[model samples]
Structures are given as C-alpha cells and as structure tokens.
Target: MIPRLVATDLDGTLLRSDGTVSPRTRDVLTALETRGVPVVFVTGRPMRWVDELHDDVGGHGLAICSNGAIVYEVADRAVRRALPLDRAIVLEVAARLRAALPGTAFALERTHGFAREDSYRSRHVEPVGTPHGTLEEILDDTVVKVLALHDEMDGDAYWRAVDRLVGDLVDVTWSSTWALVEMSAHGVTKASTLALLCAELGITSAEVVAFGDMTNDIAMLQWAGTSYAMADAHPAAQAAATHRAPGHDADGVAVVLTELFDLP
Candidate 1:
C-alpha cells in the first residue's frame, strides 16, 4: 500500500552503524519527501543528538525524539511538544530500581539539559560541568525521560529486569546495545506521540509505514499498518515487524522506500 506517512528509528535502523547517514539513504529520504511522503524520525536520542540531522533530513521535518517524550521541529531546533516525566515519578522509580537492581545508575534527560549520577556512564560526551547529582538533587519537572544504566548486565537483560521491577509503574524500553533503558511516563512511547501527530494531520495508523531495529521500536513497528525490522534487528523487533528490511549498513530503509515508491 502507498503510505501517507513514514516513521523510522534513526540510530540502528536508518543511519549506518558508523552513526552517519549514507549518501544513498539521504537521497532516498529527500526524494520520498519530494514525492509528498513525509518522513518522521522517531528515536531514543535526546534533542541534542538530533541537532546534527536537520540538514541531512532535507532541512525541515518533524522528529519524535527521546522516544515519544519530545516532538522536535528539525529546522527550527524547537520543541513542538513534549511529554515530560514527572520528577516525583522519576524519584520513585529510581528508588525502587536501585533497591531491586543494585548496579542501576540513574540519569535525567530534560528539555534544556541533562544530569546524571556519577556512576551512570554515558556513551555520548556531555558538556564539561554538566550537573552531576543524585536524583533528589538533580531531578526537576523538565525531565523528559529517565535513564537507567548497569555496566554488567546485557542490554536486553537489563531492560527485562527493569521492566519486571517497574514496568507496571512506567514505560521501560531499550535501544542501546549497552545496558541502558529509557523510561517514559506510563503509556508514553514512540507510537503514542506519533499517533497524536498523525491525528493532528488526519492520517490513520493504516496509512503509516514504520521501521526500526531494536526493542524501543517494537511498539511503533506494531502500531503501524506496515512495518519493517532492520535485518539485524533485535529478536523482539523482528517478531513485531511485518517484514524484514535490509541491514542499516546496506541502507535497508532506503532500499525499501525506493522499491515502494519507485524512487530513483
């Protein structure tokens, strides 16, 4: 079917493992929009990381960042809307997880900045003098998502344990190969916010095509009428997707898009 909208995860689904967009992928996405199929990047990335993508994505497009917590206006570098995590909820979740999973370290993603405990090892470099504090010390109402980390556990294992402990209380999902899980307020996910936007645009779920390669992308993959898991997608993601696209390194999403739309 010809889709009205296209939703895709950035890191492991669209972008190559080297974390850059391939030239072919870039052309395909731009051509997709040129043909009137808009692309929305739904990622676990914070707005900070998505900044580099504005020009690459044809200058102006919307992105669902921090999973579903923030909907960003790409060219404008503005937050169109956000579903921030309540600080009280973050504190409570952190308290409970710390008790059950001894090594879990906590961090906060806010509208304007980030803060983390000394133990949370972030892969992306934070600015010097970024806040380093306890949850009680650093948490504020601006929090968009809560990050939990464990150096010893596998990515899936860590997510499972966190979900088992607190999934009933909040939304827990993992995208990183590392032992990191991002928690959103209950019922908030990439699909939830995407649904809101599509409704605003008068698009239906049956008109949306989505792609992803990890646990975090499962909900959207399932929510879309048509979905593809990247070739090396997580087992759960593969199971949720209706089809398997080529691997990210192979510019898989682009391959599928070109075929579907008959783009050059």
Candidate 2:
C-alpha cells in the first residue's frame, strides 16, 4: 500500500551517520514527492536547523520540531502550531535541575531558537552553533525544550536521572550521549504532533510509516502504522518498532522507502 504521508525522525533516522542525508536518500525523498507522498520531519531539533534540510528537500515539507513542541510549514517558514512550556513550571524545573546537577550545562529551547546561561561553557563546551541567552531572559519567553549536558552521563544514566527527578513533569529522551528533556504545558509528544499533522493532511496514524533509533522516537514509532528501528538502534527502540532495518550508515530509511514505496 502507498503511504499517504511519511513521518521520520531526523538525527538518527533520516540522516546518515555523518549527519547529512545521503544522495540516495535525497533521490528517494524526491521521488516520494513526485509520487505525492508528503514527507514530514519529526525531530527534537529546533526549526532553525530545518533550513539546511529544507534546502535539500525543497520548501514544501513540514517539520515537527522540539520533539513536537512546534509544527512548522516550510513553504512559508511559519509555525503552524505550537505547544509551549508553562513559564512557572519550566522555571521551577530549570531551578531543580540546576540544584541537582550544579556543574551541568543547560539550554532552554524556544520556538524560534535556544538559549544558554554563560555558565554553560564550563560543562558542555562543544560548539553546536546554537546561540546563547541568559536563563532569566529565556524564562521570560515560551520554552519548548531543555537540553542538559553531562560529560560522563551515558544515555541510560541520563534518562534515569531525569525520570527520577522530573518524572511526569516533563518528557525525557536522548540522542547519542546528550540528554534532552522536553517540558510541555502538560501532555505533548511526537505522536501527538504527528496526529495533528495527519489530521491536517487528511491522513491517519494507520497510514503513516515512521522510523527512529532512540528512546525519544518510541512514542511516534508506536503510534505509526508501521514503524522501523535501525539495526544499531537502542534496545527499547528496536523492541518498539514493527520491523528492524539496516543501520543508519547502511541507508536504513532509504532501503525501506525503496521497498515500501517502490522508489527508483
């Protein structure tokens, strides 16, 4: 069956290991567009990171950013919908996180961009090109996500710590070794975001094919009609997927697209 819409996570699902979409992937995506299959990117990254991809995939795609905090229309570069964090709750969570991990670096994600305290440099010194702003100033705005950096924190420990600390107050997930905790007003997730997108496109969750490689992608994977986990995906993700595909380096998404959609 031809999927009416295709929704995929970006970092470890659609892009190759080097963090760029391969030429083969690009060709498959273009062919899907030609076949009238709407391609949507569901990611934990902010929309600012979507421009580079928009250029590659053309400006007609949709993006679910900040782990579903915001859905953007690439054609007009506008936010179609947003689920913002409650200022009071977010400020409280930030305070608690700071108290728990004194030396930890952190960033507050807004619909437009992300901000970090000057002290962030002491811990997460890696330059990811995300602009920095004071925590106080960021709290004054609508925060969509929070990223915490711990040099020695593996994915498991990171998730455990955040879950124990925040619990149901926020949604915690990881890509690589970085811990990304997304706080919403109450309940918001990639699956919910995709549901909204599916409604807009007249598609159903049963018509969507999703992919991923991390704990963050779990909800969406389970919500899709058929979900695929990468060969190198985490155990939880692999268990959640309907099927397992090749590793990201082996063009997992491309392989599935070719077989399922019969792309050239």
Candidate 3:
C-alpha cells in the first residue's frame, strides 16, 4: 500500500556516513513528492543543520527538528512551532546531572543558535565565540535540547551513565557515539513530533512510513505504519522497525523507495 506520508532520519540513515545524500535517493524522494506523498525529515538534528542540508532532498517542506522540540519550515528557515524543555526543567536537570556525573560538560541547542560551557568543547562548526558561560548563564528564552557529554565516557558507558542520571526526568537519547546525550521535554521524541504533524495533516499512523537507524530514531521507527531500520541500525532500532534497508552509503533508502513506488 502506498503511504500518505514518509519520514526519514538524516545523519546515518538518509545521508551517507560522510554526510552526502546520494543522487538516486534524492530523485526517489522527489518522485514520492510528485506522487503527492509528503516526506518529512524527522531527525534529532537542529534547525540550523536543516538550514544547511535538506536543500538537496527537496527541503521546501516542514521538518521535525531537535527531536520533536521544533517544527521548522525548510523554505524560509522559519520555526513553525517549538515544544521546548522548560527553563526550570533545563536548569534542574543540568544541576542533577553535573553532580551525579563528574566531568560531564554541557551545551545548549537553541531554536536559533548554539551555546555551551567553556568546558564543553564544540564538535560542530559554529560562528566565532559562540556564547560561552555556565548552562545557567548561556540559556536563552527558548531552549529545545540540552546536550551533555562526559569527558571520559564515549559509547555505551556514556549512554548508560547519562540515562541513569536523568532518564526519568526528561526524554533522553543519543544519535552519535560521542558520549553525548540529547534531552528534550519529557516524552518528546521523533515519534511524538511525527504524530503531531500527522494529526495536523489528517493522516493516520497506518498511512505513514518511516526510516531510521539510531536510538533517537527508534520511537519514530515504531510509530510509523511501515518502518525500516538501516542495515547498520542499532539493535534496538532493528527490533522497533518492521524491516531493514541497506546501509545509507548504499542508498538503501533509495532502493526501498524505488521498489515501493516503482519510480523511474
């Protein structure tokens, strides 16, 4: 059955590991749009990253950004809506996390730009001297995600430690293996955002298809009517999804799309 909507993750799902979108994948997505099937990019990525990429994949639509904390209009780079973690919640979580996990550094992903503690080394290229201060000092009117990383923890240990500290307080998940934990409003996730958007569009979960790879993408993978986990997807994602596609580098999404829609 043809879906009314299709959703996909970016970093390690839709885009190759090197962050390139294959031409075949691009064309297949275009074909879906032409057939009146709306495709949504549901990712943990910030709106800023959408501002940078997504143009290559017909980004003139709405995107679920910041792990459902933000709805962004790709065309104008405007925020349609934002479900933010309350400032109080942000502060409280940061405090608890800091005390429980020594050497845990912090950063903020605002609706507009980025902010981080002086101790938090940035992994993304941001404008010079991006706001630097305590998490309390750097906070703005709207904070979509609170990014936390440990100086030592990198993979599973990092995930386990952070998850233990605040998993009960807010929604916590990770897209990368950098000991980074992305926290949003409690219970907010890609699935939450997708469901909200589908409601607005008058579509049903049974009418949607989704694709993802990481833990951050798991909720979305489960929520969609038909979902695919990438060949290299985490074990949890594989369990959540209905099927598996080839890895992103192989244009796995494109291959599945081609067979689904029979696009030339």
Candidate that would win on TM-score:
1
**Residue by residue across 1-264, what tens digits does model 2's lDDT show?**
677888888887888867898988888888888788899998887777776677675543888888888988876788998888777777676777778865556677677566777656433333466666667665645678776666556657766786678766777666655544445545678888899879877898889999989887899999999999999898999999999989888889999989998665
In model 3, where do residues sit more than 4 Å from their true spots? 58-60
Per-model TM values vs. the true structure: 0.97, 0.90, 0.96
Residue-level lDDT of model 3, residues 1-264, one tens digit each, is: 878888999888989988887888878877887788888888888887877785685453578999999988887777888987788888888888888888888899887688999899877787676899888899876888999988677667777777788888889988887788899989899999889999999999999889999999989988999999999998999999999999999999889888887777
Residue 100 shift from truth in candidate 3, angstroms = 1.3
Which lDDT values do the candidates have, in the order given?
A: 0.90, 0.78, 0.86
For residue 140, give model 3's deviation from the true position in Å. Answer: 2.6
TM-score of 3: 0.96
**lDDT measured at residue 154 in model 2 versus the true structure, 0 to 100:** 64
Ten residues in sequence with the least summed lDDT for candidate 2 = 119-128
Candidate 1 vs candidate 3, lDDT winner: 1
- Candidate 1: deviation at residue 170, Å? 1.3
> How much lDDT does candidate 1 score?
0.90
For residues 1-264, what per-residue lDDT tens digits would candidate 1 score against the true structure?
799899999998999989899999988877877777878999999998898776787363789998899999988888999888877778789889989889989888899888999888888889677898677888888998999999988888888889999888789989887898999989999999999999999999999999999989999999999999999999999999999999999999999988888786
> Which stretches of model 2 miss by more than 4 angstroms?
122-134, 179-185
